[model samples]
Target: QIAQESEPGLAVYALAAQADMYRWRGDHAQARAVLSKARQLAEEKGLDFEQRGLLPVAEGITLAESGEVKAGLRLLSDGVRFLEQRRAKRELARARFLLAKAHLLAGDKPQAVGELRRALDLAEEIGTHQFAVVEGQHAVGLLKLGIAQGVAPCRALAEKVQQLGGLGAAEVRTGEGAEEGAASRLEIYALGEGRVVRDGHTVSSSEWRTAIVKELFFYILLHGPLERDAIGVVFWPDVSAKKMADSFHTTLYRMRRALGGDVVVVEGGQYRLGDVDYWFDVEEFEALVERARLLPPHAWQAEDLWRRAVALYRGDFLPEVQRVWCVPKREALREMYLEALVGMGRCHEARREFEGAVGWYRRALEVDELREDIHRRIMHCHAQAGRRSEALAQYHRCREILKRELDIEPSVETKGLYERMAGKGPD
Candidate 1:
C-alpha cells in the first residue's frame, strides 16, 4: 500500500519500506538492491534527511545477512550517526535495531544489548509497533547475554522466553540447559590424536565414580603432576592436614581403579598420568606451549604452534573449579598463555605479518589488560606496519587507560616508539 503511493517524495520512503519487508523475509540481496536504488534516488532528488538516512541502515542489514558482519557494523554505525544528526527518532531506532543484530552476530553481545536498549527507548518515544516487536526479540538476546556473563537471571530469562512464545525460546532453553547439565557432570577428557573406543562406543571418563577423582585427574593433567602437599593445599585448603591427606589418598585410589590399573603412576611422591596413547586436552595444551617455547627464535612454525595453543584455551583453566589452590595455578597459566600470545605477536611482527601480529597482540591484551609490555608491543607493531594513525590512536588509548586505571605514564620505550611513528624522533 505504501509503495503504491504516487507522490514524488514518497518514492524513497516506499522503497525503504519494501526493502525492510524483503529484509524481514530473508531476501537480503533484493533488499540491498532496492536500498541502493532508493539511496541514489533520494540523493538525486535532494530528498529530506529522513528519507536519505534509511539507505545506510538497509545496506548494513543486507551486508550483515550476506556475511560481511564487520562492514555491516561500520555501515550501521554510520547510519546511526546520520539519523542522530537529523534527530529522526524512527530512523534512528531502526538503525540501532539493525546495529544490535549485527553486533550479536559478531559475538559482541554486550554492545548489542546496549544498542537494543537504546532502540527500545526510541521505540517507546515514537510509539512504533515494530519497535515493540523488536523489543521482544531483544529479550532473547538479553537472555543469551545473561548466560554468557554467568548471571543467575539467565534461568529466569529462559523461563520468561518459554512463556512469551518468542522465536528463540527452544534454542535458548536447550543451549543454556545443556550447558548447565554439562557443567554439573564430572567429565574427563583425553587429549590426543585418533579415536579410542571401548565395545564399539567412545570411552567417557564421566562414568567415573566421584567428582573429586575427576577433578584430581584434571589438575594433574593441567599442572604436570603436583606433589602431594601441593595437591592437598589446592583442593582441601580449609581441611585439616591429616584429613586432606586422607581425602587425597581416597580420591587417588578411586582414580587409579577407574583407569583400570593401566594408566596412572606415582613417582618420587608425585602422581602422574601413565603413558597413554590418548592425551587430555590440558596435556595437549601444555605440550603445545612447550613446543612453542622450544622452537628456534623467529621460526616460521612458532606462530602456528602458538595459535593452536591459544585455540585450546577455551576459557580460564578449570573455570568450573574455584578452590584456593586452583586460583594461583589459574593465574599462572593465564600469564603464560598471554606471554605466548605476545611472543607470537612479536614473531609475526618481525616477519611483516602486521594484521596477524595485531590480532595476537589484541588477544594478549584481552587476556591481561595490566600487561604494559603488550600495549607497547601493539603500539610498535602498528607503527612499524605504516599504520601511524592507528599507532597514535593506540598510544592515546594506552595513555588514557594508564592514567585512569594505574595513575602512571607510558614507559620510555613506548614514548620512543610513538615518537618514531609520528616522525618526531631520530630518523
Candidate 2:
C-alpha cells in the first residue's frame, strides 16, 4: 500500500504481473478484474506506449484462454501490429508465442505451427534464446521443429533448454479435453515405414490406388495441415500447375476417404489432420523425451526416458517413403537420439557409474562413431574405472575414426584427455 501510494507507476506493472499470475492459475475472473485495474492504473498514471503496450497482448491471451477467441485475437493482433510498427524485436517473440498458444487452444494447430515458426524465426533473427527457456512448450516445440527443418541455431538453443530443464506454463486445454477422451482409432507409424492402421485394420500400400496417395496421406499426417501450394511444390515440383492442383485434390480426397471424412480437414486455409482419434509414434517418442527434459538435470528419470526413447526409434523416420522432406526430420530425430544416449551417459557418470556411462557412450558412437566428444567421454569413463589400457584403446579408435571419416587430427582437448588418462602427462 505504501509503495502503491508512493509509486503508482511501479504499482501498474505489479498489478499487471499479478493479473498474469492469476490467469496462469485458471482464475480468469480474478485475472480480468486485476487486469482492468492495472490498465486503469496505467492510464491514470499517464504511462506511455513503452510501459503499457503489451498489457493488451497479455490481456488478449488471458481472455482467449477463457473462451473468447475472436475478441482476444482482435486485440492480440492489434497489439502485435503495434509491436511490428515499432520493430520491437525481442517482445515480438513473446507476443507471437502467446498468439500461437492461443491458436493451439482454439483448435487451430496449423496456424499455431505457423505462428510458432514465426516466433522462433524472430528469436533466431535477434541471435538470442529470447527467453525461450521460460516459454517451455512453444520454445521447445520450435526447437524440435527447427531441428527437423535443419535450422542449425535451434540445436544449440534446444540443448541449452534441455539441460536447464525445459520451461513453460500449463497448457490451456478447452476442446482438447474432449479430444483426450476419444479412443484412438488410427495408429500412424512414420519411424520406419509410413505405416497406417485404420479402424483396427492395417492399410496396405495397394489400397491407395496411386503410388503417391499413401505418401501424401503420411506427409499431411506427419508434417501438415500444410498449405495447398506448399504441398503441391513438395510433391509435384515439375508438374504443370493445373496438373499439380488436380493431383493434390485427388490425393487429398483419397486421404480423407481412406482415413475418414473428418481426418484430413481443411480449416483456416490449411489442410490438416483434424481432431481425430489417432496416435503417432513420433509424437509419443517426443513426449517421452519432453517429459524427461522437464526433470532436473542428472535426475534419475532422464536416463529411463532415454531408454524408452531409444527403444521407440525403431529405425530412421519414414524410411520406406523416400521424400526430400523426410531427410531433415530423420536427421533431427537421430540427433535427438544421439543426445539422449549422451545424456544417459552423463547421468550415469554423475552417479560415478563409469562402466555404465561408457556403455551409453558406445551406443551413441554406434549411431555416429565420429563424435569426438563421445569418444572423450568413453576415455574419461574408462580412466575413472582405472582401465588405462581400455582408455588408450578408445583414444586410438577415436583418432582412427577422425582420420578415416574427416581426415583431421584430434583436437588438443581430446589428446590432453588421453594423455591424462594414460598417466603419461601432468594430471
Instruction: Kindly report which residue stretches of model 2 are placed more than 4 angstroms away from their true locations once superposed.
Output: 1-184, 296-298
> For each candidate, what TM-score against the reference?
0.46, 0.56
lDDT of 1: 0.65
lDDT per residue (tens digit) for residues 51-155 in model 2: 435777878877665545566777777778888888897877878877876665455556766776787789889887645655543234444444544545555
Clashes per candidate, residues 3 or more apart or on different chains: 4, 3
Task: Tell me how far the alpha carbon of residue 348 in candidate 2 is from the true structure, in angstroms, after superposition.
Answer: 2.7
Q: Tell me how candidate 2 scores on lDDT.
A: 0.71
Clashes of 2: 3
Best by TM-score: 2
Candidate 1: segments with Cα more than 4 A from true spot? 1-210, 220-250, 256-258, 261-278, 294-298
